[model samples]
Target chain A: MTTREIILARLRAALAPAPAPVEAPREYRRDAPVDLDRLVDRLTDYRAHVHRVAEPAVADTVAAILPAGATVVVPPALPPAWLPATVTARSDDDLDHTTIAAADGVITAAAVAIADTGTVILDGSPDQGRRVLSLLPDLHICVIRTAQVVANVPQALSRLTPHRPLTWISGPSATSDIELNRVEGVHGPRTLHLILLP
Target chain B: MSRTFLGMPTTAPKGVGHLRGAEPFPAAARRALSDAQLRRNLGHATATIRAKSGAVVAEVPDWEQLRAAGSAIKADAMARLPELLEQLEQRVTDAGGVVHWAADANEANAIVVDLVRATGSDRVIKVKSMVTQEIGLNEALEAAGIAPVETDLAELIVQLGEDRPSHILVPAIHRNRAEIREIFLRAMPGVDPGLTDEPAVLAAAARRFLRQTFLSTPVAVSGANFAVAETGTLAVVESEGNGRMCLTLPRTLITVMGVEKVVPTWRDLEVFLQLLPRASTGERMNPYTSMWTGVSPGDGPQEFHLVLLDNGRSAVLADEVGRQALHCIRCSACLNVCPVYERTGGHAYGSVYPGPIGAVLSPQLTGVADNASLPYASSLCGACYDACPVKINIPELLVHLRDQAPHPRGESAAMAAAAYAMDHPALYAAAQRATRLSRLTGRRGRGLPPPLSGWTADRDLPEPPAQTFRQWWASR
Candidate 1:
């Protein structure tokens, strides 16, 4: 028999005497009230820059996070109204390593945001682009609407589709692997700027 | 040597590094205990991690509920492992990814080596994976003349220092910053001579050294944190972005995951995502979590391979009482909180796994007789059970494994004789009076004689009462 057959057969025999599968009790606190202030607090606690802005000031907030003449990569479906005129914004339609890496930062809208953990989930939606567009850049400027913010992980997960690629960004890249001491910024975007649209 | 993969009597795998070691845990732990440097490093690192884990875990009011959910989800998945794996394989295959199965380490290594060879890349970048360590993948790749570059900072430190990973999450926890600086200067080609002992500086040095490799390496090998059977997505949760780089940049991605890592659905991640970060790194969320459902048209790896490794997982699954060891999420929470692990460190455990989880898991995977000493490595303090994210009752499992382990003939005979004597009143009284005779040999504050001296080396045995408890009861 093939190794696959052997392994499957082995699993069958092993699980024969095993007890029937039981649905895990979901008694855990699945619902928590979402608060924009709490989200900002959590994000800032992880050293991520959180910018609270009005709908009209979203572009200005993005501009404020970047320097003049900086090249920003945006998803093809990003709203043109959210782009500041002063900075250079390019659509990541034909993303190559050079273009994505050369861009100063990526501006993408989040599919869902977990307020408790300060995490923004991007599911490669039209506006979110591919996972690479946001990962290769040195800075990731994630825009999340207040309405999209959920209180906890379960709430955020409930809102996401599993088939699409997802990237969950809590803060800027950090590592505690060195002597178990946390040092922020390793391989992914060194800087994470969250623009909260309230 | 040929052994059965349950029924198939295939050739024995060449490098199944996860098996039990030749050296016993006591002797190895004795060597580990005498190393002052290892003791200090482990002592400080575990203490820091333990405190941080406690603080973050406390922030979530329903942490226990989350742990229960995690455990139940794993149990459910394990109960229907074969069906979940079949579903996972089909989903992955439908999503334009290839799936392979390996009976043991040799077959897994051969598949991976062949994959890398087919890519025609002499070098491959690696994300930190415990499965790869367990399979001795790097050594296998090196033997095949392929250079595997470890991209994770701690892994890089270990690789450059020519040392094995002591800790699971933080592979280089045993190394101090100064030692790391010296290693980087000596081993990392073109590293700045002016590098300081600051963690930031060392991390930056690793980034500089590995950036080109990440960008250039065509093939990447990784271990999955979880594989969802529902949608066939694989998740890699990590603090540093090295995992992201390896998961994203490489053209060909091969994930070698144990069969037990399969979860029923992506929804189950809500429990694990919360449980793992708080337990492993004390973070509300790890900095980067990448999830992919096979190959995306324009994103991530264009070619993907998922190798399901059985090495010893099926053997472990066969035992009804022992199968819960598969519920481990590799969080290292138990290791940090374990009193025994804190003093002896990870090296003494011998296997790729160590500490409380290792005590139960190693024996189960390799058979209790092969790793007999591991089950006795614990002091049964039960700290590991409290700290375990999945609520694995490690102390109970340790005792269970100890029962399965082979005892020395003399020890077994002594236990049997005692059991026999205790069953009979006359024999019990005679045995008790025989033990009291030894008390007359030494006066108060004197050392014990030959065979009993080994016991007194650590603590003095209390003097026996003049009359046996049964005799005193009878007289009263």
Candidate 2:
């Protein structure tokens, strides 16, 4: 018999006196009022820069955040209007790792944002592009629409499609490995700028 | 055949993996307790995490309800593990991914080695995975002429120091900042000569050291924090961007997961995702969590292989009362809260899994006889049970395993004699009166003689009261 068969057999035999099925309790809060203040508070707690702006001002915000003469990588379907006029915007259609690494920053749209956790979820959507686009660059400028912001994780998960690849960024990369001290910026984008748009 | 005689044996097969420590828990704990430096590191780290975890857990009004839901979800998954695993395999295979089954660590290791060799990549970057550490996967890769690079900062420290991980969340919890700086200066290539012990500086040094490797490594090995059986989605929760670097940049991604890690549905993640971050690292949410289903074209790794590893997990599942240990999410909350763990540290437990959870789990995985001393390693403080996100009753499991552990003949005899004496009032009285003889030895009995000396070796033997309780009661 194959190892799979053997393992299955063992499991089946071991569970001969099968345990009774248990129903998981879903008593935890599933939804709450979306509090933008709470979201900003959480984002700020994680050391992420949060900017609340009008939808049309996204370009200006991006431009202000980036250094002068900076080149930013954006997903292929990212709104052209959102691209800063001051900085060079490169699409990630045929971007290589070296180029992505060398880029000053990355800009993308989030699929959903969790207010309570300060998390932005990307579903490999047209605007968010691939996972690597946000990972390789030192700076990540994620734009989240007010309509896409949810109160908690459950609401965010329900809004997301599981089959697509997902990256949940709570903050710029951080670690608590040294003496359990939280240090921000390791291997991932050191600077995370969240542009909340209405 | 008699019905009673036909019962099945549920214990795990012997000589399988790294579950057992070379010496018993007491001996190893003795060595660890002597290391004052280790004690200080563990004390400081655990205290800090406990405070952090406590504060975050307090922020949620429904934390208990969440814990209950998390526990039930895991129990439901385990009760129907076979079905969930089969469903997961079918879904993963349908999504342009390959799934392999390994009954033991050696088989799992061989499968990973061959897959790396087939990719023709001699170096594979790795995420910090407890399961991989449990199986000693890095050593297996090295034996096959493959170098495994650990990307997690704590794991990197452990690897460079050629040290065993002492804590789950922070592997190098035994080392402080100065020690980490020393390790980096000695081992890290191209490190700045003026590096300081500041955490940010050390982290930047690691980022600089691994940046080129992350960009170039063709293959990566990871362990899943949770795998959704329904959607074939795997989630890896990490702090640093290294997880993303390894998961995204590598051409071939291989994930080794314990079969028990499978959850019934994607929706079940809400409970765990909330409970885990609060209980671990005391954060509302960790910095990064990556979830992928099989492979994504023009996205992350196009080639994906999921290895479902048993390695005595089925054996752990066989025991009715003992199986709850499988419900652990590896949060390390129990370790941080455990007093015994704070004192002796993870090395004393002698398994990749340490602290209260390990005390119960290691014995069951390797069988009671192999890891007998581990069951007694705990003080049954019930702190781990309270701290567990999945509500695993670790103290209960410890007491249960202790019942199954072998006891020395002399101890058993002594217990039998005590029981008999207690059964007879006259004998009990005589025994109590005879205990007054111990007072002759002084206020504190220095040590007992012969077979009983083992008990008093590490513990204090107080002097017997001058008057027996029975005599005092009669006089009153």
Candidate 3:
């Protein structure tokens, strides 16, 4: 028999007297009323800058965080209205590593925003671009609609697609590797800016 | 060098799947305790992690429910492990990923070495994985002339310093800033001589050194935090971007996973994802959690292979009461909160897994007799039980494992004699009278010589009292 068959045989023998699998008792909180205020507070606690802006003023929030003439990379599906006209914008569809690394920051939309943990889930959807676009650059400016915010983890998981590559970002790239002391800004974006639109 | 089909040793004559350690727990712990610097380093590190986990765990009001869900989910997975694995293999194969099964570490390492060799690359980038460490994959690769570069910051510290991991989460928890700086200067080529002990400086130096390797390395090896049997999705949860880089940039990816890591569904991840980050690194969510299902056309690692390793998990699962140890998520929460672990650190455990979980796990994964001293390592204060995220009854399991360990013939004989004496009331009273006679020889509640002195080495024995309680009651 192949090693796989042997292992399966062993497992079957071991599990003979064990009970069958049952539904997990998920009596924990599954949903919350999408609270943008709580989301902003939690995001802020993770050291990500929380910018609450009117839908029309989205470009201004992006402009405020970046220097003049700053080169920004945006996912191909990113709404053009979100990027300020003053800065040079490059679409991330056909960008190379060195080119993306050279950009000042990345701007994209999140598939869902988890309010409880202050996490933003990106599913490589059209607007979110590929995982590399958000990862290689030094700064990330993520936009989440108020409607995308979910109260808790189970609620957030229900909305996400399992097959798509997922990057769940809570804060800027951080590390507690040094004596377990948390210091932000390691490899991903050093600065994470979350814009919540009502 | 390997185990037979029956899980007996092929190279080593006696113990199979046992870690190579000469000193027992007490001997190693004594040495670890005397090292003042190591003690301070471990003390500060565990204390900080403990406080952070406590704060985050308290925030979730339904944390207890979440723990129960996590436990039940794992129990269900173990119950249906065979079917789940078959489903996993089929799903991964359908998703364009290959799955290989290895009965022990030797087979797993050989498979990984051959995979890297097939890539025509002698070097591979590694993400921090306990299973790979458990199997001694690095040593196997090195023997095959393949160089594996560790990318996680703590792992980099351990690798550069030519050291073994002392803590599960923070492998270099025994080393502080000054020591890390020294290791970097001595080992890291072309590093700045003027580098300071500041964490940011050290971290940046590591980033600069590893970035070139991440970009250049064609093949990467990782351990999966969770592999969903239903969808064949694999998750790698990490604090640093090193994991992300390895998962994405590499052309070929090989993931070594213990069979017990399988979750029945992707949604089962919600409980663990919440429990893990909070329990480890005390974060509401870690900086990055990367999940992928097999191979994607243009995204991350064109070639994917999952090596399902069952080095000794089958043995662990065979024991009815002891199987609960498989529920460990490798969050290191129990390690951080364990009072014994805080003082002794990971090195004393003499296994890749250390702390309260390791003490219970290592002995069972190997034969209990091979790691006989481990069950006695704990004070049984039940601190590990309270801190465990999955609510593994670690204390009860420790006692169960102790029963499996081979006791000294003399000790068993003494125990039998004591039991016999206690069963007879007249003899029990006579034995009490005999114990009271020690008061005459053992002056000042101490100084009982020879066999009795072992008990009073660090503590004074309570005076037996001149009269037995029964005699005093009779007089009253």
Best-matching candidate per DockQ = 2
lDDT of 1 by residue, B1-476 (tens): 22244553222243466556658988889999999998998899998998888999998999989989999999999999999999999999999999999988888999999999999999999999999988889988999999999989989988999987888899888888888899999999999998999988888788778878888889999999999999999999998888988998889999999999999987899899999999999888988899998899888899999999988788788777788999999999999998988998888898889889988987777667778889989889999899999998888888888888876575576678889998998988887878777656575425566554544554555677888888889899
Better of 2 and 3 by DockQ: 2
Off by over 4 Å in 3: B1-18, B440-462
For each candidate, the DockQ is 0.67, 0.68, 0.60
Where in model 2 is the C-alpha error above 4 Å?
B1-17, B440-445
- Tens digits of per-residue lDDT, candidate 3, B1-476, equal 33245533111123323354567898999999999999898888888888898999999999999999999999989888989999999999999999999988889889999999999999999999999988888988999999999999999999999998988888999999999999999999889999999998888888778777877889999999999998999999987788988898888999999999999998999899999999989988898999999888877789999999888788788887878899999999989988888888899998888988999888888778778989888889998989888999999999998888887675577789999999999999999989867756566546666555554664676767778888999899
By DockQ, is 1 or 2 better? 2
> How far does residue A172 in candidate 2 sit from its true spot (Å)?
0.6
Q: Clash pairs of candidate 2?
A: none
| Native-referenced Cα lDDT, model 1 | 0.87
CAPRI band for model 1: medium
lDDT of 1 at A84: 90
User: All candidates' TM-scores?
Assistant: 0.96, 0.97, 0.95
Residue B28 displacement in candidate 2 (angstroms)? 2.2
